[model samples]
Target: MFIRFLKENRYVSLLLTFLRLYLGWQWLHAGWGKISDGTFDASGFLNGAVKNMSGEHPSVQPWWGYFLKEVALPYVDLFNVLVPWGEFFVGLGLILGVFTSFSILMGLTMNFAYMFSGTTSTNPQMVLIGIFILIAGVNAGKIGLDHWFIPFFRRMLFKNTEKEFPQNI
Candidate 1:
């Protein structure tokens, strides 16, 4: 049964793996560039974007701007710090296939946030990527550290769970 599953899914797996690797590399490269550019103050950019959202010619201005100004700005600086790091880490995790489920979740969250920010152009692309990641479960791809680490992770986390282990085990 295990062998059959692997054999049948080989091509599908390869395709999804390729997509995952490509997306992961893209995200990682972008995030790495942002992190390395010390002059790129995320806080300033976020604040400026927020302010622009309130402007008449704003690129993206959702009704949430009011709430963002009132509630979000209070912690905007903190968000600035965490968001970039989150992007960097999530990209790294995806690329390495480590904590893949968590990484996908984070990517989805980020993509959704961007989508709803009144930016329709970016939303569609990000939404499609998020859907692909969710559907592919590309975390099970070949050439990933996850293949080596997931077993250890499962053992540590599900030590007492016999039924939950992979069927082949």
Candidate 2:
């Protein structure tokens, strides 16, 4: 039974692994460029260039500017420092297959927040990515470090018996 299930679902796992690696590389490359530049000061460029647009009005400011300003801006400097690093780490984790579930969850959460902000054309893309991550069950370790580390971590952190992998329908 287990062998049959694995055989049937093997393609799904492979697809997810490839998807994760591609998405991870895309994010990592973008974040790495930003990190290398070592400057988050887009205030003038953004306010000047993107503050006015026909379709969305403000394309430079991320979708969640209001939240970043009204809510998150109090610590805007801190956010500037953390956000790039967070993106890099998320990308790295996804590519390496380490903490794959958490990495996907974090990306999904961030993308959802952006989608809710009602500011960018990228919202649709973000939604699509989220759907892909969910459908792929990207957390189900396949050719990644999570296959080994997750079990050890689970055993160390939780006292409950390990759960069995669900059969593919």
Model 2 stretches with alpha carbons more than 4 Å out: 1-8, 42-66, 119-123, 135-140, 158-169
* Separate clash counts for every candidate: 0, 0
Model 2 pairs whose backbones collide: none
Give each model's whole-structure lDDT.
0.63, 0.61
**Per-model TM-score on C-alpha atoms:** 0.72, 0.69
Model 2 has how many clashing residue pairs? 0
Q: What is the C-alpha RMSD of each candidate to the true structure, in Å?
A: 4.7, 5.5
| Residue-level lDDT tens digits of model 2 in 25-115 | 8667766877888986534422333333225554434545554445554665676666677778878988898877678777777666544
lDDT of 2 at 148: 81
C-alpha positional error of residue 50 in candidate 2 after TM-score superposition, expressed in Å: 12
